[model samples]
Target: MQQCYGSIIRRQQHLIRCLSTKMQSFSMSGLEVDAVSVLRSLAPALDPNKHKGQAGKIAVLGGCREYTGAPYFTAISALKIGADLSHVICTKDAAPVIKSYSPELIVHPLLEESYNVRDEDKQSISTRVLAEVDKWLERFDCLVIGPGLGRDPFLLDCVSEIMKHARRSNVPMVIDGDGLFLVTNCLELVSGYPLAVLTPNINEYKRLVQKVLNCDVNDQDGPQQLLSLANSIGGVTILRKGHSDYISDGKEVKSVSIYGSPRRCGGQGDILSGSVAVFLAWARQLASKGEHNTNPAMLGCIAGSALMRKAASVAFEDKKRSTLTTDIIECLGRSLEDICPVH
Candidate 1:
């Protein structure tokens, strides 16, 4: 009992310090955020009295037969970054492979691809998929809606239904990978939902701009263009990933130019998605407690961008040219510790 009380006290003290630290952090026209400080403030304290799922419960809604590594990277990275529980809901063909990657994840083989289902079965199968996801829909703090998610029409349709359910449940989502592909074509999936965050790389961002604003990518007025996209989508946050990460939730924009590695690896974006989901969950908790007034989605993006970049930088420093996505994942814990040490 004494230990438990001590842990609570320590947790409260940590948050107090985090709050004080945030007040001192600097920004310029809100164009840049103090990402390191925001990360520290958003990350909850390590408390012994906290039980399982108290830290966070994250779900990754992706993984397919052709691409298992991306989901594995996303789920495991969430676990490594301090989420208490991480789950993957994927097609049956990909579930075993993702499960084999790590026993830490609770893998659900619930989704169906077009190839496996008949036209008559698709309607029934999609209903089953949504039902299965709904069983645990409200349990997750956030859903990462794409990491190995392929562009199968049937699969994407089911995912679209799942998104509607999650939004109805008020569950936050970090969308990336082919999930962007789905949202690009069907803007209504995330159109007016404030809890949705779209993390887009160059190509994805280009497509989104073209689809939404009816124009090409504007590097000259990138910040304003990003703001316009977010506003047009009804305040859903967008994290435009590049040499420098830019984030906006229609109301405001922020940038993180922290130095990351030059290793243009395929799976780094997966790490960002998972990291953003976890941090977004934490940020939401902080907001619910009235600890911070900033938008949790915006805060989550800033912190995730900073931490991912820092981890990539550390991994590159150690492995240089040989740095793989796994190497960057390995660095998440240490990089976060460097920013916000456990008390």
Candidate 2:
């Protein structure tokens, strides 16, 4: 492991040098990482000999009767990025809708809302839900929390239990949307877990700052505040989504300022969460084999952010004002090809 990390550190230095020499003669905010290089290094080579589930198995833990598109967007995003399987665990009413969205996804209608369950059954239902999730827990490479996850009290409690189990099992998670809501209230859930990644947008970022740091979001020294935020949570990665997505794992801050679209679509963050899950999986797989030894969480954020931005740009050029989140997702393959083409 030491030798592997040594080689990776040297390679990272080389990439940084290249970023300075090859790119334009202008200074960029934060450390401008060579995101394309990182993506290429992490993405596995295609091999016909590899069987099913060798690539990745991703699960999205969100979706309710009121909202099903969020989970569908996330799960399909993983499949489009070359994951082997995509599973969505949602409420009973949400399962059929999410399944109807795509036959490719494995929909489990197992979660319960407050209106559907009695107080006497909350404990047993929560236990049963956790059990069902546990049966397939170790099989997944990553779990994306809070896509269409509503703010129901009982449902949130069950999801909290699921998060705890995932932590115990050492499964990585990308928390977004309402998952941030759950984590904001209970920081201990991801306080020291290195594998937990928080993808907080503008509003979510504000709430985290207030709750975790006891201060407001400081735009004047954005990277510094971001560093403090991540460190405050004990080094879990934070991918602060914005015009220039800034990533920090409590040590250093890296920014990917690639121009995306002006259209701020709703499901774009879902796409990013799914993308990060796959890239993080690939990075960790390599690390397990002593291939590369940096923080997979940060690499995953950088690569995922870069790819999503590129795809958004392409989609905007093609569709202009009509560019939606779905359009951006449709361009994921082409954007990746633009970065690192297959031979």
Q: Best candidate, TM-score-wise?
A: 2
Error at 55, model 1, angstroms: 0.6
Model 1 pairs whose backbones collide = none
What TM-score against the true fold does each predicted structure earn?
A: 0.91, 0.92
Error at 257, model 1, angstroms: 0.6
Q: How close is candidate 2 to the true structure, as a TM-score?
A: 0.92
Give candidate 1 misplaced runs (Cα > 4 Å). 1-30
What lDDT does model 2 reach?
Answer: 0.92
CA shift of 276, model 2, Å: 0.5
CA deviation > 4 Å runs, candidate 2: 1-30
Error of 2 at 252 (Å): 0.8
Backbone collision count in every prediction?
0, 0
**Model 1 clash tally?**
0
